[model samples]
Target: MAVKVKKIERKKMPFLERIYIFYIIAGMARTFRHFIRNLLNTKNIEFLEYPEQKPEDITPRYRGLHRLTKYESGELKCVACDMCATACPAKCIYIEACEVEGSKEKAPKVFNIDLLECVFCGLCVEACPKDAIRMDSGIFTKVEGKREDFISDINELSSRKRGDF
Candidate 1:
């Protein structure tokens, strides 16, 4: 099949439009207008003194940070089943299993979650059969400092309290 090529003629732009002075001025005017409106209507703007005043809108279902729960006997609830690691889509969870001292049960010798790679999907919590892993600590994940700081290990995950943001 032969294809027909059709060319459309474009109209030449005027000097003012070509230079873009009008567009720049218009953008500046819009910015100034918004700035003036926002400045004058400051009462509508809400500000929180963060770290000092937490927002009240954080819902109960909000998944903040990962934490490892403990049993009443002061033992880790995780049996090192590796279900959370397997269920992680980002592959950020790492678990190394070790046999419990006197029992046939196994436990994690090294359980680490890289916060940088974690998608915070809460799949780890759902995958855990023992209900060891939870994302309901309410401690916000603040990204700061070195790469090594972002990795949450067994001790760190186990020790996180509810208010330790």
Candidate 2:
């Protein structure tokens, strides 16, 4: 196939446009304004020197890690539906589902959230027909020795009260 090429033209910027110092000063002013506001209002601070202070709680709507759930009867709530795993665009969720006693549908007996790969997009929780898997856990991740170490149990993930979840 033959292709035709067009000439590229470059334009020169005027004095003010070429000298980016104006932009720099504007940025500095904005940054200082934010800093001043944050200094006065503790809520506006963006930087966190972690381990020095208690971490701020994420909103109940904010999704962090993945979690499995159980019915009030102590039966697995996941029904092995695979909705969460299927909805995961990152493909980070791994669920090994097995049948529960006297149940027709399967449930995830071994569900693992790969913290290394999880994008934490919250799609998994939204896709679940059952309110089984949730990211509403305000627990920001703690340190783990390995990637596998970050793989926490449901109890660890759901350390807070039912209201917290």
- Each candidate structure's TM-score, on Cα atoms with residue i matched to residue i, is 0.77, 0.65
Best by TM-score: 1
Q: What is the C-alpha lDDT of each candidate?
A: 0.91, 0.72
True-vs-predicted CA distance for residue 61, candidate 2, Å: 1.6
| 97: Cα error in model 2, Å | 1.5
lDDT of candidate 1?
0.91
Query: How do the residues 1-165 of candidate 2 rate in per-residue lDDT, one tens digit apiece?
Result: 989999999898888989898999999999999888888999755676864664556566766556566677866577768888899998877778787678688866767777777888888888999888777554556687777786665455434334353
Error of 1 at 93 (Å): 0.7
* Deviation of model 2 at 104, angstroms: 0.9
lDDT (Cα, 0-100) at 147 in candidate 1: 94
Candidate 1, residues 72-136: lDDT per residue as tens digits?
Answer: 89899999999999999999999999998899999999999999999999999999999999998
